[model samples]
Target: MRLGPDTLGTLPAEIAQCGYDRAGQAIGVVHFGIGAFHRAHQAWYLDRAMAAGERDWAISALTLRSPTVAEQLGPQDGLYSLTERAGAGERTRVIGAVREVLFARPDAERAIERVAAPECRIVSFTVTEKGYCRAESGGLDLERAQESFYPVLSAALAQRAARGQAGVTLLSCDNLAGNGAVLHGLVREWLAAHSPDTLAWFEANCTSPSTMVDRIVPRTTEADLQALEERLGLEDRGAVFTERFSQWVIEDDFAARRPRWEELGVQMVADVAPYEAAKLRMLNGAHSLLAYCGLRAGHTYVHEAAGDPALRQLAERLMVDEAMPTLDPAPGQDLAAYARDLLTRFADPALRHRLDQIAMDGTQKIPQRWLDTAAWHCARGQAPGAIREAFDAWCWHLADARFVDDPEAKRLVRAASGGGRQTLLDACFGGGAGAPLWPEYAHLRPLFEGRRGGS
Candidate 1:
């Protein structure tokens, strides 16, 4: 039987201790982009907060682009099983923080209404890097505003302002650097285009708290569902599989009411920039490198890539030599330990984090992950060798017909096909040509070019 309120009582006794019985929690948060990561990370944290006696923080999850998640989870009354895997062991938790789910296409007004509600004091979301509709210069990409969440949020905030609703906190759980500020800037630009008064109201009211979220949530597959079903003795199409590790470091700034999330394992820090930089550069940067290099070396998943000696070495070199040097770690934080932990997590054979999945939207991800770190190294007369290799792998991946999905695929592949690696690097630097990739790695440029052509 499908898991729902009706079936809650019938869930195995083993699952009883998992999530608290959220029988009458109010929907205090309206989150956009209902995906596996959101469910696994944010909702999971909220579930713990509720379990610890917070009542008014249940989430009204909304999907902006598709109804697929809502369709799968709605039937179960927004309840789903999170199966955390580590090697041969599995731990299942029935997350209940999602009190309601909505599809934004046909229910945009409803979504706006929900966010405008008095109880909805927090509007949080996890729409990935590309979802921000960011421009090349790191501000809001004004041209892509219509297709972004910014416009939708602007409309919702306008309604709230019109209704004289109190300000709500807008928390961003995406991996972007200064994600909260980024979202805030985007919303401001969006409102500027549509309603300047609403922009004024928002500036006086809402707060976008930056957050650093860490977790490995691979896209759920049928095998995961089958494994869940066998374990629970019930068909749970809404089940999501994730690694046993998770971390959420949020800036301690909110406009209105919020859960006492700090008591529930969430690090409420004053300055999240240090944490954000370290994770972005070391963890996400290495992940992208692994994605490109691993795929080129015939590996399918993160563990497979991490287990490969050559790829593993490359990842370590990138993390310690290239990425870590760029980061100014928090006081007393062990950078080496952090890098080792990431490699250990990456090598977890239970999680099947696909390279193609991480490699998506390379054009959007490159600026923050690679280019920033590369620029840092270049300014010091140091060669970003590991990053160059990863960039080469990305170019090679784009050139391959099998690998398709990057927004800049056509241009990148064209460059890689004819002009080799230099053309691709030149494009990344916006026609700066060989300057960024110069001096330190100038002698090594031909190596990458020769490898790409020879292959």
Candidate 2:
């Protein structure tokens, strides 16, 4: 049987399911960018929260640029399965946190109206790093911002303000450091330029809490879907699979009604920067290193490369020697333990996390992942060899890889031309007059250029 409200009785008895009636919940949250990660992590949490009796936080998921998720889940009444795997064991649960789904392309106005609704107390999104439409200087890309989600969001805020509706919290679930604050600035910048009135109202009312979200949600494949069908004896078009590990550290700031997320395992803290910095550098940075360098060495998935002795050494060196020195975690937080967990997580063979997926948007990711740490090390008179090697791998990935999916791919490819290490670095760094560099940059070039076995 196909999964939907009508097929609820047909759901497998062994499958963990939501106990709450979907009709009992109101749409208190609207999540933009209904991708697999959002479904597996955020929606999964909300589903558990509602099932555990936090009934006021049902979600209405929206996809801005694509109708793919809506097309798949709408027929099922926004119900989908989240299969969490660890080693050979897996748990499947039907999620009903997303009570409604919207495709922004055809129903843009309705989406805006939903955001403006008084019932929608929280508006969160998982638009990837590039979806923010940030410029080279890390601010709002003015031209792109005009054509991006910011305008629609700004209009929604305008509608709310005009209707005298209460302001809502805007949470960003993307992997970017200081994601909420960054999103707040982008919205403020866009509104300051486009609608001053909305800007004034938003400044006085809304809150954007910075968040650090972690989960390994690989893109679903046909094989995964087929296996899920076999195991469950039902057709679930919106099924998503992810690793057993999941985390959400949010700065305790909210303008409206906050979901009882503490009951559902979300870490609400006084400060999120320390955690955010740690994850971005230690976990995400190492992932980038593995992606570019690993793929160049003929590995397809993260586990394949992370399991390799040479690649594992490189990752360890990058995290411990290069990345960790730049981070200062909270008093009780264990940075060393976190580093150990990152490697273990990456090496999970069950989760086929693709290097190419992690490698996308290299330009946007580099500033936070490697460049910032490299700059920090340089200011302290450190060499930062591992970071430089990663950059070299990134350049090579651009020049030689079968596919490059960066917005700046054309420019990066041009800059990656064969002259030497400096030429490639200069091109990748955009030929800036005062570009950041490590003391041992020159020495690091040959290692990457030679495609040496290890870091």
TM-score of each: 0.93, 0.93
lDDT of each: 0.81, 0.84
Tell how far residue 402 is off in model 2, in angstroms.
0.9
Clashing pairs in model 1, backbone N/Cα/C closer than 3 A: none
User: Any idea what lDDT model 2 has?
Assistant: 0.84
Predicted candidate 2 versus true structure: per-residue lDDT over 130-227, tens digit per residue? 88987656678789866557877888999999988889999998888889889999999999898888988999899999999999999899999999
Compared with the true structure, model 1 gives a TM-score of 0.93
Q: Point to the candidate with the largest lDDT.
A: 2
Off by over 4 Å in 2: 417-423, 432-455
Native-to-model Cα distance after best TM-score fit, residue 100 in candidate 1, in Å: 2.0
